[model samples]
Structure formats: structure tokens, C-alpha cells
Target: MKTVAVIDYGMGNLHSASKALEHVADRNTRVVVTCDPETILQADRVVLPGVGAIRDCMAEIRRRGVDDVVRQVVASERPLLGICVGMQVMLNHSEENGGVECLGLMSGNVKFFGRNLKDAAGNKLKVPHMGWSMVDQHQPHALWQGIEKNARFYFVHSYHAHAVDDEVAVGRCDYGVNFDVALAKGTVFAVQFHPEKSAANGLRLLENFLQWSP
Candidate 1:
């Protein structure tokens, strides 16, 4: 049976993410939410989901020793999905918490959407960039299999990822500015938006991930 491990480092809405994964997973697949490094490394796939601040998230990730597990999973070439702060932590550094160092798995930086932001209509844009936004698929990838083009995904983040190389970005979204909402390299796929909260499209993305080989 296929096993998918949802890394639990004391951050993320683990219940929601695990439930969503369970809901979409096949009868033979097992979805486990755990902090155990052995379980994570042995799983068929790994998911790192986070919801809170980068500093706290990174601290817990390191404290729980999940950071090494994540690196190992990435190195194993097994599919790894990172959500929200989980994705941000993969960058070189985050502008949040006065700039915190990250895993540096990807060559990029996390930047906060400045307060002086505005929409095309000149209306003040919110800091967190909450609510749903259309995701513009930049390039074709396995994760985008069943998801339609320009599908709206749920987002609730202030800081967004900026890839050093544009080729890493597989999806883009606009919130007063165009920023990368999804990144893909080899077997790693991460998104700033919350797929579990994104309704149909979000669930479809997760389902696709479950079946994605590379």
C-alpha cells in the first residue's frame, strides 16, 4: 500500500490537511500525520504543511528534527509537497520575523507584500493577501494535471516566494503584484496557497499529487 506522511512539526493545521488527504486518497493508500523521522523517510510521499510564522515554524521544524527528514525525502527523489509557510521555509531566507534564514533547498527569497500596495483600481490591498486568487499556470507540470488553467486557489499569506530563476515557477498569482504561487523542481512541488481550503480545484491538485510520479 502507498503511504503518505504529513510531517507534523507542531505548526500547520494538521487535522484539516490530513483529513483532506484522507478524503482524496485511495482505499489502499494510508495517510499518516506524524513527526517520526523514520515514518516520514519511509513513506511513499511527504507533505510539509505550515500555517504560522516562519520563525516559529523553522524553530519547531529544527527542534523536532523534521528538517533533516525533509532534506532526506527531497534527496530520495520521492515526491514532496510543501504548503504555505512550509513552502516559504524552503527558500534561502524569509523577510518575515525581520528576515529569518530558511532551509535554502531552493534558490529564492521570501518577501513580504509591502503595506503600500494597491489593486489596479487603486484600492488599498490587504497585508495578508487573504481570500481566493486565480492561479496562472506558468508551465506544464505533473501537479497541474487535472487542475484547470487560471483556477482560483485559497491564499492567506503576507510573504511570497521569489525564485532566483524564473524557470522554477510553475504557477503565478497576482495580489497587487505578480508573484510565484507555485514552484516545481525535480520531485519537489510547493505552493503558497492552501489546497485543502481551496475547494474543488484544491482537492484536485492534492489528488493529482497523490498519483504524480515525478
Candidate 2:
């Protein structure tokens, strides 16, 4: 049984994310909606949930002094999943809230959408790609287990992650433009969409993460 620690820094959609994982993992998992660094350190698996600014998220984790623990989890080769803003923090830097430093877990920069507007029928699309969108598969990854290629998943985000290495980008989605939808490098896995709010496909994705073996 894997003890998944749903990291709570008072900055993410904690409850819904936990509920989704619970339905899928079926293993020993706890929503550590705590600021205690030890709680995050001791867990076998960690899920970082986010919904706000990257700087704030980093600040909260730093306030709890679990930044090192987070790094440790990344270094330990344990399963670490980030969602939405959680996914943004995985990058080396972000251009949100006047720009801020990030975990640098993955070598890339997070940028706001609509920066590269494509001519779509001579019309510009909106930022914050919201609602249910299809995840474009880049390669085979465990997080995408039981999910069909180009499966629709719920998403609500303005900023997006861009991996320095395309190989790390497991999935992508086209908003006004195409961006990394999901990333998996080493033991770290992250998604830009909210599987908790994505229904059946989302649950299956969560289940795969639960059963995923390094």
C-alpha cells in the first residue's frame, strides 16, 4: 500500500484533488493538508496541488520549510505529481506575479498563454484555456495509463509550463497555441489539467498514477 501525501500549503484545491486520488489509488493515502515539513518528507508518494500564483505557492512551501523536503522527494526518485499551478511550480522559473523563482525541478520557464496568438480564422482566442480540453499525447507515460490519445480532460489555467527537453513533455494541448499538457521526468510527473474534475478519464488517469511503479 502506498501512502500518498496530498501536499497542502493552503494554496491549492486540496479537497477535490484528494477525493479524486482516493477513488483511484485505493491504497493507503493521506491528504496531508498540513504545513509540517516532516509530514511531506515521510510520505511514500507526494501530490502537490496548486491553484494560485507561483510566487505565493513557493512562499507557502518556504514558510513551512518543506522546500528542501520537496527537493528530497524529487531526488529520492519517489512519485511526485503536481497539478495546475502545482505543475507550474515544477519549472525553473515563472513569469507570474512580476516573475518569481520556482523549484527548478524541471528546466523550463512558465509563461502566460496568448503570448503566441495564432491566426485562427482571422480571430484571436482567449487566454486561460478553460473547460474540458483534449490532451495531445507526445509519448507513452504511466500518468496517461488507460487514457486514450487525445482524450478530453478538464482544464482551467492561464500560465503553462514549457519543458526544455521535449522528451520530458508527455502530453500537450492546443489552446490558442500548443503547450506542454503533462510532463514526466525521472520520478516527477505533472499535469496542467484537473483530473479530479475530468470525470471517468480523469479517474482512470489517477488510478494509473496509483498503480504506477518506478
Candidate 3:
């Protein structure tokens, strides 16, 4: 059976991610949420799901040696998905926790939305940018199959992906500012929103991922 390993680095949402993946993944596919490097390395596909401070997330990821495993996964061209802080940690650096260095799997950095964030109309917006927001699929990708053009997804974070390789974003959303929500390079695809917390649209995205070849 094909295996999909969801890395459990303490800062991740293991239960929710595993359940979500299992819900979409076929019976022939095995989903293993583990902290073991070998388990992750052996998997046909991998997911990096996280929630928490970037500083602590990086600390625990390195402490558990999952960072190296992820690098190997990308190097080998296995399909890898990063959710929330998991997506943030794949960047070069993050301004969270005073400042934290990331895995640099992708070319970019995470940034804060600012203390006094306001929408286009200048309405005061919250720091975390919580709740459902529209995600515009500007650049088409396999993971977005069956999902609407500007579908709403659950978001709960103050930081967001700023720029990716200085090119157009695959998915862009406006909270108080325009930021990248979904990114794709090679076989790797990442989203800043929590698809598990999202509804049917979220499930569709996951299903697309399972069927996606690239």
C-alpha cells in the first residue's frame, strides 16, 4: 500500500491532518502521523502540518530531525503538502518570535500583517486574520482542481507568505493586504489556510491532492 506520512513535530495538528487526509485518501493508501524520520522518509507522500510560534516550531523540527527528512522528500520529488505554520516554515525566514530562520525549501519569507491592519475600505481588521476568506486561484495548479476560483478557506494567523521567487502567486488572498495563500513548485504544494477546518471546498482540495500527479 502507498503510505503518506504526516510529520508529528509537537507543533503540528496531527490528529486533524491525519483524519482529513484519511477522509480523502483511498483505502489502499496508508496515512501515518509520526515523528520518526524513517517513517517519514519511507512514505510515498508527506505532509507538514503545524500550528504555533515559528521559533518553537523550528526548534522542535530540528530537535526531531524532521527538517532533514523533509529536505530529502523534496529532493526526491515526492508530493509534499505544507499547511499553516508548516507552510510558513518552508520559507527562508519568518518575522515571527522576534525572528526565526526557516527550512528555506522555497524562496520567500513570512511577514506580519502589522499591528493596525485595515481592509481596502480602511476598516480596522484583527491581527490574526481569523475566519473564512476568499482565495483567488491566480495561477492554476493541480491541487486547486474542482475548487472555485475565489473560494473561501479558514485562516488563523497574523503572518503570511509575502513573495515566492518574485513571481506571481498560485493563490492570492486579501485580508488587510494581498498575500500568497497557496504556492506550488515542482511536486510540492503548500497552503497557508487550514483545509481541515474548512468545509466541502477544503475536502475537494484534499481530494485533488490525492489524485494530483504533480
Candidate 4:
């Protein structure tokens, strides 16, 4: 049985993520929603979930002194996943909240959507990029296992990740501009979409993560 640590920094919703994972992976998997560094380090996997500003998330992580625990967990090559704003923390930097530094687990920058940007249909779109959107897989990744082409997932992010190397980009979504919707490198995998809120596709995504080897 694999224990997944659902990192609780008091930044975003926790029950939704835990419940979704529990449903997909079954009761054998334990979901630890906590800010405790010790528990996070001891867990077999980590899932960072958030829905607040980047600065606040970072601050909470630092305040709890779990930043190093996150680094250690990823350094050990164990599984680690980040969702939405949680995914943004995996980048090197973010332009939001007056420019703040991120966890640096992945070499990338997070940027916001343009206000005047239009979709491929030439219609003006909203900034937050809310509601259900399509995620196109750009590369083979366990995080996307069993996922079909043009699968729609729930998203509520205003910013997107720009990986320094496009190879790490496993999925992309278009919103005025094409953004790095998902990222994967070694044991570290993250998505800008909220899998817990993405329905069956999201559950399969979590199931895939549970099935991921190394």
C-alpha cells in the first residue's frame, strides 16, 4: 500500500483532492493532509494542492519549514505531484504576487494569461481560464497514462508554466497563447489542471500516478 502525502499548507482545498485520490486508488492508499514536515518526508508520495496566491503558498511552506522536506522528497526520486497553484510552486519563479521565488524543483517560469488574448476561434476569452478545458498530450508520461486525445479537465489558473526546456512539457492548453499545461521529470510530475475536479479523466490521471514506477 502506497501512502500519499497530500501537502496541506492551508493554501487551497484538501478534502476534494483526498477524496478523489481515495476513490481512484482505493482505501489501501492513505492520504495525509498535513503541514507537518516529518509526515511528508515519511510518506511514499507527495501531492501538493493549492488554490491561492503563489506567495502565500510559498510562505506557508516556509513557515512550516517543510520546504526542505519537499526538496528532500523529490531528491530521493520518490513520486511528487503538484496541482494548479501547487504546480506553480514547482517552477523557479512566478510573476504573480510581486515576483516571488518558487520551489525550483523544475526549471521554469510561471506567467499570467493575457487580457486581450483570444482562442483559436478568435473569440475573446476570460483571464482565469476557468471551467473545463482540453489537455493535449505532447509527450509520453505516466501522469497521463490511459488518457485519450482531446480530454477535457477542470482548470482555474490564471498563470501558466513556461518550461526552460520544452521536453519537460508533457501537456499543453491553448488560451490566447499555448501554455505548458503539464510537466514531468523523473519522479516529479505536475499539472496545471485540477485532477480532483476533472471527473473520470481526472481519476484515471490519479490512478496512473499511483501506477507510476519510480
Model 1, span 1-214: residue lDDT tens: 9999999888998999999999999999999999989999999999999988999999998898888898999999999999999899988999899989999899999998998999999999989899999999998998898888999999999888898988899999998888998998889999999999999999999999999988
lDDT of 1 at 163: 89
Cα lDDT of model 1 overall?
Answer: 0.92
Candidate 2: pairs in clash: none
Model 2 vs truth, CA RMSD: 1.8
- Backbone collisions counted per model: 0, 0, 0, 0
User: For model 4, how does the per-residue alpha-carbon lDDT over 72-166 read when each residue is reduced to its tens digit?
Assistant: 99888899988888888888999998899998888999997867878788899888888998888988887777889879999888888899988
- Which of candidates 2 and 4 reaches a greater TM-score? 4
**Which pairs of residues have clashing backbones in candidate 1?**
none
Question: Could you arrange the candidates by lDDT from highest to lowest?
Answer: 1, 3, 4, 2
lDDT (Cα atoms) of all candidates against the true structure: 0.92, 0.83, 0.88, 0.87
Question: Which digits, one per residue and each the tens of the lDDT, describe model 2 over residues 1-214?
Answer: 4478888778989899888887776546544565566777778888888987778888997887667888988888888888998888888899888899998888888888755565467676666677998888898987777788899999988888789999999999887767897999888889989989999998888888777787
- For candidate 4, the per-residue lDDT at 49 reads 86
143-207 per-residue lDDT for model 3 (tens digits)? 88888889999999989997566453689999888899988888888999999889898888887
Q: Which residue pairs show backbone clashes in model 3?
A: none
